[model samples]
Target: MIYLDNAATTRTAPEVVEAMLPYFTEQYGNPSAIYSLGSAGKKAINEARRTIAAAIGAKPEEIYFTAGGTEADNWALKAAAECCAGKGRHIITTKIEHHAVLHACGYLEKNGYEVTYLDVDRDGILDPESLKEAIRPDTVLISVMFANNEIGTIQPIREIGAIARERGILFHTDAVQAFGQVPIDVEEMHIDMLSASAHKLNGPKGTGMLYIRSGLKIRSFIHGGAQEKGVRAGTENVPGIVGFAAAVRRALSRMEEKAGRERELRDYLIRRIEGEIPYCRLNGHREKRLPGNVNISFRFIEGESLLIMLDMRGVCASSGSACTSGSLDPSHVLLAIGLEHEEAHGSLRMTLSEENTQEELDEVVGHLAEIVQRLRDMSPLYEDFMKSRRDRT
Candidate 1:
């Protein structure tokens, strides 16, 4: 199969698996325990923390392990809101954020905290000026994503962070899609909190981290024992954490080469699809997007139908986020980027990995063109729209 859904999740690397095996059986003690086996577990967790910290220019003490990006996001949004309730109960975020942030904000709103959802430009980029204008005397935090998962448009996080810093408001970024694939420095970006997931970078599932800058204090997320510096409590997933660190090290080591290759292939696919298919438009900024992301909307075809057709042809892709796959509604991200409901419903997202090849992508593009054409032919809406255009001309 031609797998092109890396944004949903990646195949765990063999090296990461190798590094995790010993922890599963041999060193299975809890890090909170004081015995020798537990000591080994604690050591491994610390080493993983340090490795992950260095990769993102954070100190080891600032890294707090979590179940995954969703948990990290939940913790960041909720805890920050609660932590600064006295300062203000208002939070700011973009409309194109992953549901993790959006839903968390929804919860906050139901519980007395007010949230401002900023709109993105047509290319799916949030404006720093908009954020500045949205900030009020009661605004306590601004949580914007580093890169949009559906459109892959990279946000101007540094500029947004600067705005927040100048206002004494905390800044948080959900970097689930951009962490391992793109370069990031929390300190340089003035980010107070950043979230990342290991599974997105060829590491084990159920493992992620939240970076909290030194001197920043958020309330506890999970409560039980004194794990994760007493903030996130629970027995650590030693193996998953170890594997996460291994994957981070490997991904960063070859990030430049992998990104370059993926960008070439992504550009080629975009050109091919747009050239071969009529009434299809590419989504997101052409140049300021993720290196391996290709999102396009076919004018008359439904995204679900196209996804099924592509899957039958041995192509693994997505219409939107895996988290919201089965929903009948159009993608919020697409709609937030100014697409009409029908246009949003017809989008396709193909996120690649370094393992994909030019030949494979070319073949996928051919299949896609044929499939889209066939679907459009079956669409009465498309035929009527074309006839109307001809009549107007």
Candidate 2:
């Protein structure tokens, strides 16, 4: 199959698997134990922490392990809100955020805190001026995603961070989609907290990290053990952690080359789709988007029907975030970027990887064009519109 859904998750790298094997069997000891094997486990875990921390320009002590990006997002948003209650009960985030942040904010609203959902422009970019205007005396935290999962729009995080820093409000970014694929420096960007998942970068699932800047106190998310410096309580997934570090190191080593290749392919697919397909628009900022993302809204067809057709043709793709695949609702990201309900319902997201080639994209595009035409041919909307055009002419 030609896999084009890297944004949903990646196939774990063989190198990462090789690096994790020893930890699973030979070094399988609890880091909290007092034995030599336990000490070794602790050392490995610490090394993984340092590796991830250094990647984001954070200190080792500031890195906390979580189950995945969702947990990290919850910890950052909810814990920060509770911890900074004295400072304020108001939080600011964009309408295009992953549902993890949006749902957490909903919970906070029910609990008496205020959350301002900011809007993005037509290209799915959050304006810093809107953020500034939304801030109030009661605002204590600002959470914006580093990159949109659906549209792949990279936000102006540095500008937003600077604004939050000037106002003394904590800034957090959900970097799950941007962590290994893009360059990010927690210090340089003035980000107080950041969330990333290992699986997004070819590492093992069930392993992720939250970089909370030093001296930033948030409440413990999981309550049982004293692991993670008493902030996150659970036995560390030593093997997965090791694999995560290995993946991060491997990706950082060749990020520039990999990104260039993926960017080339991304643009090629975008150009092919827009040039060849009728009544379809590319989603997000064309030049300011992710290096390996292609989101398009095809008119006169349903996204689900197109996805099924693509799947039958041996190409794996998604219409929007995988998390909401079963919801039957139009994508919030697309809607937030000003797409109408029908447009949002007919979107397709095709994310790539360095492993993909131009040949694969060519096949996907060819298959996609035929599939779209087939589906649209069966669509009453397409027939009606064509009839209207003929009548007018």
Candidate RMSDs in Å, in order, are 0.9, 0.7
**lDDT, candidates in the order shown:** 0.94, 0.94
lDDT (10s digit) by residue, model 2, range 1-393: 999999999999999999999988899989899999999999999999999999999999999999999999999999999999998899999999999999999999999999999989999999899999999999999999999999999999999999999999999999999999999999889999999999999999999999999888888999998999888998989999999999999989999999999999999999899899999999999989889999999998899999998898899999989899998999999988899999999999999999999999999989989999998899999999999999999
Q: What tens-digit string does per-residue lDDT give for candidate 1 at 1-393?
A: 999999999999999999999998998988888999999999999999999999989999999999999999999999999999999899999999999999999999999999999999999998788888899999999999999999999999889888999999999999999998999999889999999999999999999999999998788998888888899988999999999999999999999999999999999999888888888888999999989999999899998999998999999999989999989999999999899999999999999999999999889988988898899999999999999999999
Best by TM-score: 2
Off by over 4 Å in 2: none
Screening candidate 2 with a backbone cut-off below 3 angstroms (N, C-alpha, C), the clashing residue pairs are: none
Q: In candidate 1, list every pair of residues with a backbone clash.
A: none
Off by over 4 Å in 1: 390-393
**What lDDT is reached at residue 249 by model 2?**
98
